[model samples]
Target chain A: MTYLLKQLGREWRFMLRQRYVLILLLCSFLVSGFAVFTGLAEVAQQQQTIERLKLADAKDRLEAQAKYNDPGSLAYYSFHLTYSEPSNLAFAALGERDVYPWKHRVRMLALEGQIYESDSQNAELAQAGKIDFVFVISALAPLFIILLFHDLIASERSSGRHDLLVSTAKSKYALWGSRGIVRFVAVVLCLMVPFYLGAMISSTGFLTTLLVSIWCIAYLAFWTVLSLWLGKKLASAPRIASILIACWVLLAFVLPILSDLLINHSVHSAKGGDILLTQRETVNDAWDLPVSTTMDAFAATHPQYADYSYQGEGFDWGWYYAFQQVGDQASTDMSNDYRAAAAKKYTLAGYATLLSPPLLLQRKINRLANTDALAAFEYEQDIRDFHKALRMAYYPWLFGQKKFDKTQLTSLPQFEDSTHNYKKVQNEQ
Target chain B: MNNKKTQFAIEANSLHVDIKNAPILRNLSFQVAEGEIYALLGGNGAGKSTTLKTLLGFNQPSSGKVFIAGQEVYSALDFIRRKTAYLPESATLYPHLSAYENVQYFLSLADIKKSEDELNQAFQRVSLQESAWHRQLQTYSKGMRQKTAIALALLREAPIFLLDEPTSGLDPVAIDEFNQLVRELASSGASILMVTHDVYGACQVADRIGLLRNGELVGEYDAPENGRIDTEQVHAAFAQRKAL
Candidate 1:
């Protein structure tokens, strides 16, 4: 152990003397620092956007409250916002959250229409990839690793140090292994120092920070091991570097696209927008049907409302809500297929990630941050549950013809997540 | 050490080698005594470098065995390498590092933690300039890099030294200086096995010379005890043998 430390010191000094490598290391740190800062800025921006949405929703609800003393009109006009607030560690890994909707505004109307409404963002940007901390460490760090260690063994052979060093050491591992380790640690630290600062500033949990640090180191090791393996196969440093860079391009860019194609080809999921459109077409057809027909359809699924026998209906709130419920009920099959396909695609993509360490690690980081597509789905599901509770809570007053107490609005169902802790943002106006 | 124990610092017993399905070395055997300077000479195709590599445990033989310090070369390579110093045909010092740093790093790699004074003494023993020790090896001439390799050997304090074309591209003065350093090492009881094309250089310093032809030891010649070598006759004999 002592001898290895001595060798590590010598190796570090040797690396420090190499000005080009040192400059590359500095560049690596700069790039990662930028990425961390940008990621945090993105998370902050999303949080601010959520805050603004909550304030806007609160103001709109107040206007609805002034117009209606009963439950039906209030339920229809009051669009409650459901948001997936960024996790504490999200700054390090802003994954699918950029492309996916982190917040949704929905009312007591057919939720199929409002639930699918996502923020307008260019998805091509997400596919092109982001410059987050995980992106820097997992994708960019390897390039620097290749620069630092591409010629590790080959250069030793060129310099005529190979034979002498080999004969001097107890074994080949003792000499070259120490050198490999030193270079690997140097590359990892170049990324980690900036990342650690970002985590500290963000106040990332100790366990989360530790896991991310391990991921960064493991990613660097993957590249180093590959560089060394290719070093053994090729004779010249340039040849080894060329093959490694080719592999980087393959794994980082090409393989991920292929994995996406494979998952899409295998697991064909209909879009949620399609389901929403179909539900709307079904609900619009309810305009031609009699109010009795709509109530009968609603009473079939919602047997609890079956016994309310007052059907003197000329567009009553109870009759309109019955058809809205009927619309959500009629599209259940398509909605389920859409949800199942999404889950299957995510699972298959995960399986495909085994072929690329970078993707696999990014997936791990995304999970830790709760910023992935599955996290998006979880948030949407949470919103769906809250919407269901809102409809159920509003039904009692509408069906029984009982007047709604304004104080009871405080007890209504709210969108919730583990990270979500929000108070009602009442308008000052 | 007794006579038999001290007689053979290196020994090969009917060694045979093949690389990638082609025979590289035929049945061969030779030995060099402690405190003796032995040179193996051959043409380009001859296995001179291969023999040195074999002795250093770089090239594994298909059959037979080599012994260094009475330990089988392959079985105890780490031990053998730890005790042997190697100088290859090219100057392979890390160009990014200064001469002193290279020496110190290699010393540490060898698990030899020496003080700066001892490292400088080794450099001085090889007659390397004190000023050049701190300069990057990239600025040094070919001969200077060879001197660093020798200084490394001196620092290692090994019992055996393997030289592969040590004076291949040096001036007469540099070659003489290098030859004198080897003589000093031999006199200090280090066994030396050198592969070279310099017949005159070998006869000038070597106690004995072996000629290899097509992987076999074709002939062995000795320098006079009076330290006189007839380069013309040695050349004539080598040329005549080649003609045959």
Candidate 2:
């Protein structure tokens, strides 16, 4: 053990002397910090946009109330905003967040159309991927592993020290094992220290954050083992290096994209765009339908209002919104099937974790950050439920059966309580 | 003849080694007795280094076996290695550590823990300058690195020493010093097996010399009965063998 520690100390001193290690480590840190700054900026900008839209919503509702002042009109015109707050650890592995929308505004119209609206973003940046802890573990850690291991025995042999060292009483296992442990610790430290700092700043939960750190360390260990095994097998340095780098490219880059493409092709999701087009057609076509026909359809769905009289109305608020609710109810099953198909992609990706740890960690981070595909799907569910509540609140007043006073307007369901329970949802997933 | 056969300290009964399907050493046989300095003289590709590696158990013989001190070397690698010391033609120490640290590290690997003063004395015996002992090996010259490796081999105190062209790259003064060291070690009953191309140096220090050509030992010469052997005659014999 003492000999191993001494050798490890020597390796660390050697790494410190190599200018490239210092340069790469500092560059990685800077890149991580820059990525975090961009992530925080992106989240803050979305939050601000939501706030502006909410204010506009309040102003537009006030203007409409000055003229219509009907609860049914307010329900039809007013839009509700929903958003997911970024998790602290999201900065470390910014996976899939860029591709999925985080903030959404939805009306009491057909829920399917409002749910699939993607946020505005540059496609090139999302493709370039995030420069986060996932990048550190999956991309840069392999390079460091190669640096430490490519010449383990070949250098000694070329310089003619292999015979001398191998002739010693020390067993082969002890010699190679010590060398590998030193390199593994050094490379793992280079990844974990910056991650720990990011976790501390972001106040990530203690246990989950440690799991992330261990996952990275284990990944580096796997590479270290591979390097030593190959180094022992091959007689030349460059060949070993090339083989290890090839493995890195296959595991990190090629396999992941291949998995995604296969999953997407296998499970054909319904055209979310087609759902939006159909919902828009259905909602707008209600205007042309006879009022008696629309009311009968709405009354069948909401039968409590079958006895209510629309005595003598010129397009009464109650009768106007009855048809809107009926249009959303028309396509509920197809909307759900669309969401389930999209969510199956995540389930398929979960099976891929056993094949590649980078994918495992990628999904783990998205699951933790609550910015994954499933979260977006659940947010759609929330939109559907809230749209149902909006109709139930206004059916009586829309038929001219009751007066919607100022108190009734203030009692509308705002999106305050919907933002809670992220941590619990992550645990369940 | 003195009516005597040298008692073998190290012997290869019949050694063969194949690396990547190419025969490096083929059906070779040699021996070094206790207190005898044996020089293995060969051309660049004549399997001198390969023979040394086989004896040291770095390369497993394809057929036949090697014996060290009357014990077979096949499955007793740990036993054979513990009793042997080796110095390659060109050695590189850790570039980030001082010469003292390099010596200490090798000593520890050999399971020898010397005090600071004892270690310094070992370094001094090798004629390593005190001023450069503390400097990192990256700043060392070729001769300094060789001296450091020599210091390590001496400190290990193994009875059998295998050197592959040990004095290949040294200057005249360093080579002479190394030759003197080899003679002293042999006189103290340590068996020295050195593979070399410098026939004259081998003649100066080696008790017996053998010439290897085309993966076969072709000539063996003992020292002259008179004062000193004619190194030029031995060279002529080697050149004649190469021509054949």
Candidate 3:
């Protein structure tokens, strides 16, 4: 261990002497800091947007109360806002959150039309990908490994030091092993320091963040071992650099896109558009159908509402709500199938972790941050549950002929529980 | 204590090396005693450099075994390397570092920790100018770089030294100084193995000379004991042996 430490010191001193290494290291640190700051700004922007939407929704509700006190009008027109706050680790990965919606405005409509909504974002920036901790770990960390290990053997030979060093009694394995370990540890420290800082600022939990740090170190070790394995065979510094860079490009970029494309084509999403179309048709057709027919359809699935069944002459809240429930039931099968297909895609992507270390590591970081596609899927599902609660809360006032006053409005179902439930679901998983 | 341990500084018994499926050295065998200076003479592509590399454990022999300091080469590579220092034709020191820093870098790899003054002393022994010792090696000439390489070798304190064409690009004064340093190192009990194409230079400094042709040692001459060997006759013998 002492010998290994000495070797590590030599490696670091060598790096320090090189101007290019200092420049590159400085650039990497600045790049990481910029990425973190930008991500924080982005997260803050999202929170501000959510706040503004909440205020707008409140004002719209106040205006609706004065003009349309009817329970059916309030349920039809009022849209409550909800959002998922960024987890502490979000600055690390910033995964699918860039493309997915964290905040949405939902009313008491059939959820098929609202659940697939996305955030307002520039598509070009999303495609270019975020420069977060995930990018630093999976992409740039290997470049650092290549820079450290590519010349391990050839530089000694070129300087005429190779033979003299090898002529000692130390085994070939120890000579190479010590050199590999030194490079691996330096690269890990370079990545982990910034990552730890981000976690500290974000207030990430200790145990989970430590696991993230280990995952970062282990991923770097795998690359260092790989670089050494190639170094032994190549025998030339420049060739070793070329081969490892090629490996990095393959693992980090090509494999993920190819796997996602293949999986998406195989399963077929049956896009949420199919559900929206079906629900809209069922809801709009209610005006042409007799009131008793709509009530009968709603009563079929929700037998609890059968006691209040009534055929009112004109614009009764009972008739209005019966049609809404009828619309939701119409698209039930398509919605369930669409959700299953998305879940299957996520499962398939998870399988890719076994083959690609970079993807495995990226997934681990995002999972720790609670910003991945899995969390997105769960959050959307919770939104659906919140919509169901909204419908149930207004059913008695809308259908049972009870009047809703300002006090009653204050006591109505809110979206705070859905936000809390999203975090709890992530923790449990 | 001159231990009779049969301490061969380097031993290559019938070693062969092949590069790109073409044989460079075929069935070469040689040994240098613990404290003697041996010079290798050859034309271009005559396998002199390859012979040194094979002994150093850089090139694994296709067929035979190599032993340095009684330990099998390539088996205990770092062990063997730690006890030997090498100077190539053009040693590329880290250009960003001063001569002292370059020496210190190698010494650190050699596992020798020295204070700044001790490192400066190594440079002084190599006859590097005091001002140049603190300046970056990139500003130094070939002779200055070679001096720094020698300083690094001296700091390592290894038992064996392998030098490839060490006097190739040096001025006459630098060459004379390097030869004197070589004699001092040899007297200090470091075995020196050198490869050079300069026949006259080899005769001036080498205790023994070996001629290589087509990857084989064709002739051997003792400079101090069996002096004034015919170079033309030796070249003829090498050419005739090449036909076989």
Candidate 4:
């Protein structure tokens, strides 16, 4: 086709002349551009925050190194910070990142209370939740599809060209098909140009960018096909537009909210608040118990510390740490239950993603960005593992009653990103 | 008359058209022979459009058949469509497309791809004015749009032409140019079937005029070659039949 190209050229020229079409395309481009810009901005802010916190952590530990000579005093005062870094492609889609806490400061205490302490995220999101590229595709794109295609048949008929064009066209199917595809390509270009640019500038993986572009094409095709089918079926432009918009509001906005409410109402998830309250109660109650009561429980778990000699237990660092460990152990079942509920919610949401394409794409973008609920869960796991290392590092000195020199502060455990492990986890699923 | 219709370019044999169980055209029979320009004249709801649509194979006739260029229309609909150039009453053109673009696009869509020069020539023949040929059709008057349709038909070069109320909105000068163009196309051996309300214009250009009433042809007139058509008599006959 030379003929088809010529036809497409004609379509492009036509669109160029249409002020409204040009405006729609430009507006969409700008919105998506800003989404990319701010998404990157958001990720950059997180990175900077993490860097600032690490510096602060270094200073805080150095100060505590001088203040607390005993290993137990240092463990009590040290606040180890853990954070999740944004993926390279996260700028294209900041799904769930706006709502989730990516960084937290945990002390050597009962961890069930420390794990769920999210920074105030919702108020910030409410103030700054501009619909990102994710919103553009899932919510706004259908409107554009309707605008571009609703009048395909009705306008031709009303203008009195339908009979003429239909009667003389080589293949009427080709005519309609070309028209739809021309607009579809235009819509895709309008949305994806900024996305590709973001992906490029982010230095995202080449194959990933290609796969995402293809995915964008298939998703846009679904809307395009729907618009064409309804456009041809309805006899008037306004009617077609109204119906498609109604479908958009229902499918994109209302249905998702409804299903979310339903899922929340039905699913019984362990409450982080409940776990925190219980863990705090258990930890406080340990202060009244005999040293043997706390040590025996702690020793049951850490038998290596069972032989530690406790003398003058009125104010012992070893005895204090033993109780802290025992309090964490006391809430072990509740913490496990809390994690299981979160995992179940994620699973339920994964299944719910099937019914709404917008939800499906949001989850997909979240997965690519490593910014989903699962990613947060993995970060928490990293925190848990790092907390264990921190405890293990100190248990020997606290049990043997050895001097904890200030130089040992540098040897304290730091959190590592478990993205590879998470990948294995994702792949196995 | 029956013996003379063997080489007909369009043939509607005992056609009865119904839409949703309501009859639109009843036992309609007519033929436009090769190189003939036939005008089907009727008031509103007289089934003139129905007859044209049935011939186009858009509507399936309850009984009887339509044959275009010796092929039964429904069986080889696309084949028949390739042979015909249709201009509906409104002369609709894409508002965002320039006159040249509209014509060129339709030509290409009809699979009659032509050079830019040929497309320009078609536009020029319609006398669409060189200045406005590249201007978007939203800036066009009704007559300009009609002329562009004519250019499209010229490019199509189809053997059969269907013009539904082709002159409903044209000024006198544009109508004269249109009549001249239709005559040229017919003289070059294209069969023309025009459904028109302007009985006088039909009388001026059509070789034969048939009047339809209540979905049936009530009056038919044939013009002798080089003879003047009596417009007054044709109008009187149309008005008299509608009164009954």
CAPRI grade of model 2: medium
**lDDT by residue for model 1 (A1-429), tens:** 876777778777777887887898899988998998898898889889988887787788878888888788888888888888888788889988878877778889887766664432445666666799988877888899888888887887766667777877766777778778877777778788887887888788899899988877878888988898888777699989999999999998799889998888888766777777777877898888877788898988878888766547466788878888888887888788888998888888888789988899999999988888888888878878888999889998888845679878877876665433233332333
Model 4 Cα lDDT, one tens digit per residue, A347-414: 88888778877777777876877768888778778888988998888888889945666676666776
* Predicted candidate 3 versus true structure: per-residue lDDT over A138-219, tens digit per residue: 8778887778777787776666556544543245544566666655565566667777777777677899788987898788
* Chain A only: TM-score per candidate: 0.92, 0.85, 0.88, 0.92
- Write candidate 4's Cα lDDT for B92-171 as tens digits: 78887888778877776776778889888988888889999889888989888888888888888899999898887789
Give the Å error, residue B149, model 1. Answer: 2.5
What are the per-model DockQ values? 0.67, 0.49, 0.39, 0.68
Off by over 4 Å in 3: A1-3, A55-68, A117-129, A152-183, A307-312, A401-406, A417-429, B1-8, B19-21, B115-121, B224-244
lDDT of 1 at B28: 82
TM-score of each: 0.92, 0.87, 0.89, 0.92
- In model 2, pairs of residues that clash are A318-A398, A318-A399
Worst 10 residues of 1 chain A by lDDT: A420-429
Q: What's the C-alpha lDDT at position A263 in model 3?
A: 90
**Which model scores highest in lDDT?**
1
Instruction: Kindly list the interface RMSD, in angstroms, of each predicted candidate in the order they appear.
Output: 1.7, 2.7, 4.0, 1.8
DockQ of 3: 0.39
Candidate 1 local distance difference test against the native: 0.81
Per-residue lDDT of B1-244 in model 3, one digit per residue for the tens?
Answer: 2212245887777878898889998888888887778888888899988887877777888887778787777776667777777787777777788887777666666667888888778878778899898899889998888888878777778888888898876789888888888888888888999998877677677777788888888778875464544556555655565576
